[model samples]
Target: MEEVFIAHGGCPHWGKMPTRDASYLREQYPHFGGFLAQRKAVDPDGILLYGHLREMLGL
Candidate 1:
């Protein structure tokens, strides 16, 4: 489960079930902010973001 993964210092896969939120992911991924910034720059209209994606990326 998600708890087990976290307990062992693990991070969820982006394509799998989204058990962790943006805050958790930000901590796990060192370049989380850069990734978001690039995503925003390329898709400012959010054409590639919606529903769970917005929540996952913290947009």
Candidate 2:
């Protein structure tokens, strides 16, 4: 799973691409982070998980 995320170049934190790679992902897959904010907006859950993943991955 970790390798999959890294291979896809996604942040693995929010399951979204990083800011540096966001533009490219946007152009390639416009819906990349579209649901991120919406997901957060709907439910504030997983915030801690995201942070943990980010920290664990050293991203």
Candidate 3:
């Protein structure tokens, strides 16, 4: 239940299923999955998350 209120990508708009799109982000970086906490714990450098954890992290 606590996970429901937790912020995934520093905001709630990212949703429970974000995508690896090439679209332009006005403020945050497009591929900035680095900001995600879960992604950081597994792969702080973001090398592994791109292929393995993208779906899990909703990014």
Q: What is the TM-score of each candidate against the true structure?
A: 0.79, 0.30, 0.23
Counted clashes in each candidate structure: 0, 0, 0
Per-candidate RMSD, Å: 1.4, 7.1, 8.6
Query: Which residue runs does candidate 3 get wrong by more than 4 Å?
Result: 1-39
lDDT of 2 by residue, 4-53 (tens): 76578744354553443444444555675765466557766755546544
Q: Local distance difference test, per candidate?
A: 0.83, 0.50, 0.47
How much is 47 displaced in model 3, in angstroms?
Answer: 1.2
Q: Among these predicted structures, which one has the highest TM-score?
A: 1
Ranking by lDDT: 1, 2, 3
Q: Residues 1-59, candidate 3: write the lDDT tens digits.
A: 32453335443344344333323232346455545655578776767655424554446
Q: Indicate whether candidate 2 or candidate 3 has the larger TM-score.
A: 2
Residue 39 lDDT, candidate 2, scale 0-100:
50
Give the per-residue lDDT digits (tens) of candidate 1, residues 33-54: 9999999899989998878888
Whole-model lDDT, model 3? 0.47
